[model samples]
Target: MKHITFYLDFISPYAYLAFEKLPAALEGVSHSVTYQPILFAGLLKHHGQLGPAEIPGKREWTYRQVLWQAHEHGIPMQMPSAHPFNPLALLRLAIACGPNRFVCETIFRHAWRGGADAADAARVQALQQQLAPGRDPASDDVKNALKQATNDAIARGLFGVPTFAVDDKLFWGFDALSMLRAYLLGDAWFATTWDAATRPTSALVRPARG
Candidate 1:
């Protein structure tokens, strides 16, 4: 059996797609999954990296690819009215609701199912009322929990959203989902090719930025 921690942020379209595709991806395998909401921006800041949407050319390419992937998998998705909107409220709400996939799903759909502004205040209120009626996402506890979740992800060596952690091995991005399933299936190549891929030391260094 495989146990996985699905690290995500609602700002990531790939993460949304992964969440939708994951159940079928692991259908025949015996596994348990925990969905964790974290701030993707915190990960970016810690790693000194810019998000795909932050780069103009890459942003367009990402949207193209995400749309194609969603279509290919037959997952229902609509490009949000904006890209890279604030996801703090949604993240805290997911954590505030306790251990429920429905909360996460509702929030994901709110962002990706309709062609709407992902950060609209009215929609946010609706989500709070519908998904976690009594929970206060703005409370200090929920805010701290999100901070801890991001910190914990950093401690575990994660630098991106839609990552799957299984048995201490991290598979990153929507593209790596198949690789994760293969690992869970006990592929022999992971013992050889996988470890070998990570063992080669860097032989060259790029000059530091000013």
Candidate 2:
């Protein structure tokens, strides 16, 4: 069986989208998925990039597009009371709660299913009661796990959430889910075009801003 490591942060709506659709995308395929809750902010800092919601027009577009995708794919989604709020607590909570499919799903739904503040005190308490129970999300072990997971992801060259890592290949974005499934199905192109596309060298580099 193929092993796939799914890297995610609950702040990403696309990650929630990918999570909902992954099982169907892998229909008739034999594979095991491991969910790793990493800090999205850590990735952004490591990669020297801004999160989607931090960009200009892209912020609004990202929301609009994901909602459109949800409608098209029949996935239930609603805008949270906020976007790009701190996801550290949620990430640590996911780890503290065991980081399994059920844990991750419950957390994602809490953030994505209702049009309310995912980080609101009441909402977070509800999640803790239901999913984590008596587990301490702020405990040292859970906190370290999240940090280590994010470091490992950065080392793997992952710059974003909703990433699927199959062996050495990294597929980023919910839009790339189809590509990931194609790889899982043993598509010949992955052995051909996929390698060829990355085999070229850049003729020129853009000058760095002074």
Error of 2 at 5 (Å): 0.5
Off by over 4 Å in 1: none
lDDT of each: 0.90, 0.90
Model 1, range 1-61, lDDT digits (tens) per residue?
A: 7899999999999999999989888889889899999999999999888999999999999
Identify the leading candidate in terms of TM-score: 1
Tell me the TM-score of each prediction against the true structure: 0.96, 0.95
Colliding residue pairs in candidate 2? none
Stretches > 4 Å off in candidate 2: none
Cand. 1 Cα-lDDT: 0.90
Q: After superposition, how far is residue 88 of candidate 1 from its true place, in Å?
A: 0.5
lDDT of 2 by residue, 1-210 (tens): 889999999999999999999999889888999999999999888877788899999999999999999999999999998887878878888888889999999999999987988888788978888884456899887788889999999999999989999999999988898898888889999887987898889999988667
How far in Å is the alpha carbon of 109 misplaced in model 2? 0.7
lDDT of the structure predicted as candidate 2:
0.90
